[model samples]
Target chain A: MKRRDFLIGAAATGAFTAAPHIWRKDTSLARASNGEIKVGVLFSLTGTTGIIEESLNKATLLAIEEINDAGGINGMKIVPVVEDPASDPATFAVKARKLVVGDKCVSVFGSYTSASRKAVLPVFEKRDNLYWYPTLYEGRECSKNVIYTGAVPNQQQDEFIPWLVEKFGKKFYLIGSNYIYPKEENNYCKKLLEELGAEVVNEEYVPLGHSEFSSVINKIQSTQPNVIFSTVVGDSVVALHRQYRAAGLDPDKMPMASLTTSENEVAAMGGDAAAGHFTSAPYFMVHQSPENERFVEAYKSRWGGDKVTHFVSEPSYFQIYLFKQAVEQLAASDIDPTTIREAVKGQELIAPQGKVHLEAENLHTWLWPKIAMAKSDGQFEVLRDSKEWLKPEPYAAYPNQHCTADGLVQS
Target chain B: MEFFLQQIMTGLSIGSILLLIALGLAIIYGSMGVINMAHGEFVMLGAYGAWAMNAFFGVGLLPSLIVVFLGVGALGWLVERGVIRFLYRRTLDTILATWGLGVMLQQMIRLSAGGELRYVEMPSVLTGTVGILGVDVPGYRVFIFVFVAALFAVTWYLMFRTTFGTKLRAVVQDRSVASCFGIDADKVYSLTFAYGAGLAGLAGALVAPLKSVSPEMGTTYVVDAFFVVVLGGVQSLFGTVASALMLGELTGGLAYLWNDTIAKALVLLAIIVLIRFRPQGLFVSRIRS
Candidate 1:
């Protein structure tokens, strides 16, 4: 069969017979004098989240290339056996197993959405491998086999939500994709909103790819809430925001804030349409920092300036270096899970977003979170910045019940 | 009372978009039995065509509709003549071939367009909301409701009153008899396929403003269109309309009460129960094979 047909067959079946991956014996991830170190780079190169995941994949490859160029990892070159999960959870699991059993890579680095991460978590845990996931997500999750360099729930919300509440009114509306991240985030959001004596007027969940929001918009108009807290991701973000704007609801009057919307989405939706929206992230392309400026220049020179890099791509780029730093710290000929995981605990990097240090216990990172308003130029105007790094709370510390303004239990 | 009216209006508008999509599939897969899997890709093409016209030539949405109809319809004609025409008798092969053809088209657009979501701006006149029954209804949605009604009337007239429609229906029922009566079956099939494709393109162009234009944008639409076509009965256009209305209203009302994902699950279950009882659809034609 032709090469094109072969790709279609593989995509259709989720796994093809002639993948050309030699069924190698499950070997150890040891550095050899003559052999190259293979690292698994699995991400969605195609599918629903492919557009954003493509940048993550590039960031991983660039970091690996940079490491290999800098005299290799202890004089042994690192090679990546890339696999495409195609944004399907089952396909992600199948590829993760292949990376562990067939390629025998030291660790895998990828996954943008939480569902994909959860799917591959068992594979890594079962085999005692490392999966470096670098996207800020809904918190309350920690796996012994995964290094989550992304900001957790508290790190993203503490600085931004309070500021928003102070600036806007006390009433809020929650909108998001019906998934783990959005649901969990909205749950945490409701608790926090109530704790601050704010009222959550309405909460709604739509499927991931849902673009039609007329009925929902009608409900929004009638209710006329203070703010719309959104965790909606992917193409639906563009759809919902565009439709919301078209329906004559001035975002300036009733702002829409999201944990997921970033510079990448702003660029996709055009500045004119997505302008005035609020987003909180650990890193923004418009951030003013010496390290960020240099990193942005390097990224632009490598991959044209037209392409925008967000928090996920930045963390993804640094996570690979974080891996290399840990491996170099070991200074041993072998690279295994235990050594890498232990070394990663206290590892630090002067990443594009100032500094990131992995907290040992939770395996989460301590990084600065900033808030920005999207501009029509497809960039952001940084409105708020936390000068001090917030501690990572994998599961936020909060009372189960919400307290009203009078110090009485609301429910 | 206002809430009930608003919900029903929402359902009708949603059903109109579904009708626009399923109408084309009714002609191709319903009557023609070709199972054109690339129907959604045809919608994507029409969206892109509208985007290109507006960006390059400063053409507005109304004029672009006509251009997209002809352009995409012509492309459909070429595909039917070159590929689908040969595999008409082989059901399984036709399904697989169309499926493969769809993947190729998706990848081809992905490679050329770079896979980022593209937005098509709405015209200024359709951007605001109108007060209806003490509620604000989106203007573009109201436009879609009216536009679909007019299109349906025109389609009905063309099918029932025109010579071409008679020839097309004759070829569909008995190809040899139609051939014996000097009605060229080949021309009828080709025109019928092109017309169905043209309708899909129109659906795409109209929805481009509300939905972002991406290579995979058609996946959701095609799935919903298939549900409408199959549950409504393969051979009846009115069946497509009635089924789309039922499914659309059920989804909107359920989603308004619950959430979108749950409403979608319930709708699928409802269709399953529906098809179980009425296998021949809501309206079955009495024509003999």
Candidate 2:
């Protein structure tokens, strides 16, 4: 009888240990398992970029909802952990750390400007997590930990410059807000323009928050370049455009091609000012793909019909799918980040713009960009499109230029 | 020789705007001993007010200027009566409170106008360039220089000559004594705050044609204005004007040669050294006995 009692006690202890193991595995699989993945959305919800990012955040939420409704990634429900960076770089870094280390988010997707991205880069690198940054940036950076889903200089400026040259010829006036991205991007363009046998009439910069451009606008008017290549960002774009129009400089006569101005800027520029301007971005409001149509409808339904969609939001939406594809390819109940990272490499996504393929070298994606004419309604009428996806070359291919494919990768 | 003269003219044009803004800050700090952190916001308010008037009424430049001046002045009065009056005796509290108020005002503007810069149309008269010593200077900038100089002359006359100005100055020197002299110190304070704010509004309206009008655009000027106030003895208007012109020339001239960041850093270093030598400022004036 004593022997029987000892055996029963041992069995009870064994069951107690086994029960927790079973429940933990089950809960883990249920919450973040085969049917669950936790991804973080970091955005500047309260900073200078907040007005632009609000639309992006809403679109991101809408995309997640639609994806979940369509049975999620590999039959797993996608969970998004949203964090507000408040537009402060230091705060962005802190939130990025919390999202990666504390929440154990597999990937973080957001950042409007280079400053914010630079702030969050270390966090992703230290944590060895995936970071999908969706903004046009000054290229010359290649990192193993981050995937640049936006336009590189080659993707944006290469085509943009040649197109301007064909339309408006070589003499160009360059204006931009004084900042790293503008300065670097314009510098790249200046090199490219000279390579293409074009002349830079005048290159001017205003302080980032400089509202008055009477001086600059007057300068541009007097210079009378064949075209104005503007790299202005934030509120400055609207001001510059309005001042351009006010100066009686006709767009048709001396056209303005902007790399930074998007549909989001049109609302700020007002219909009268932004109308008839040309903008080049990877995404536009009036893209005629079925996927984009569905995205627009869903976004409108989510954020009201009057809400306008912009370029930044679409890539943010695409990030969720990209993460899901990575998760599905790994196909493990508990995702090992290294495996997920491997899976993310060479992942081809049928995005709203077109098929986007991840470059194995720098982890930047090769996505087709759409050139759109700004309409009065704050929507882009896709004027011209490169239906074929342009492979992203972060460095210039010209022999004269020092930029090389390996230039982006630091030793 | 031409380039040097051109730089001076450019410096002077920029200096005019800086001086107007610094003058407004100087007056409020001189009278109330409060920094009035929302001074920039008042400028923003005036710019927006002018823009709105132009949009709604299609008013000419002069009319829009008048509307902005009066509208922003009323806003100043409201802000003074509703918010600033309560925190006057406590200097640190006034500064902190005004800072909060400034942020709140910027956010409100953002909500109303979105976070984009609005363009204020320069009238036909303000367009084009004027040749100065064989150098082409923007016509609007020259206008700005003349307008600000006239504004200073008017402000100087009013402050040093008028009965109301004497009462305001009396209150600044000693509020209890001014009250004992039946000056109605509270009323004098309110008027002085409103006048300072009105001046800022005028400065904003004037600058709208030259700069983008955005919500947080004011923040960029606040630090520069602070430098101006401290460099010029904060209690003295003439000192404020002189310091603003010197700083503007120093910054603009340096910016022409150096990278903007390096130029700003140099200015900051110079200011630090000056402050070490004369903690009060370049020009110090004793209060009226």
Q: Which candidate is the best by DockQ?
A: 1
Candidate 2 per-residue C-alpha lDDT over A191-222 given as tens digits, one digit per residue, 9 for 90 to 100: 88988999998887766765545455545655
TM-score of each: 0.89, 0.82
Q: Score candidate 1 by lDDT.
A: 0.84
Model 1, residue A51: distance off in Å is: 2.3
List pairs with backbone clashes in candidate 1.
Answer: none
Q: On residues A43-150, what C-alpha lDDT tens digit does candidate 1 reach at each position?
A: 899988888998999878878887888887777788888999998999999999999888877789989888899899899989989999999987676577888888
Predicted structure 2: clash tally: 7
Q: Write the per-residue lDDT of candidate 2 for residues B217-260, one digit (tens) a residue.
A: 77877777888889988788888888888887877677666434
**Candidate 1: RMSD to truth:** 9.0
lDDT of 2 at A337: 59
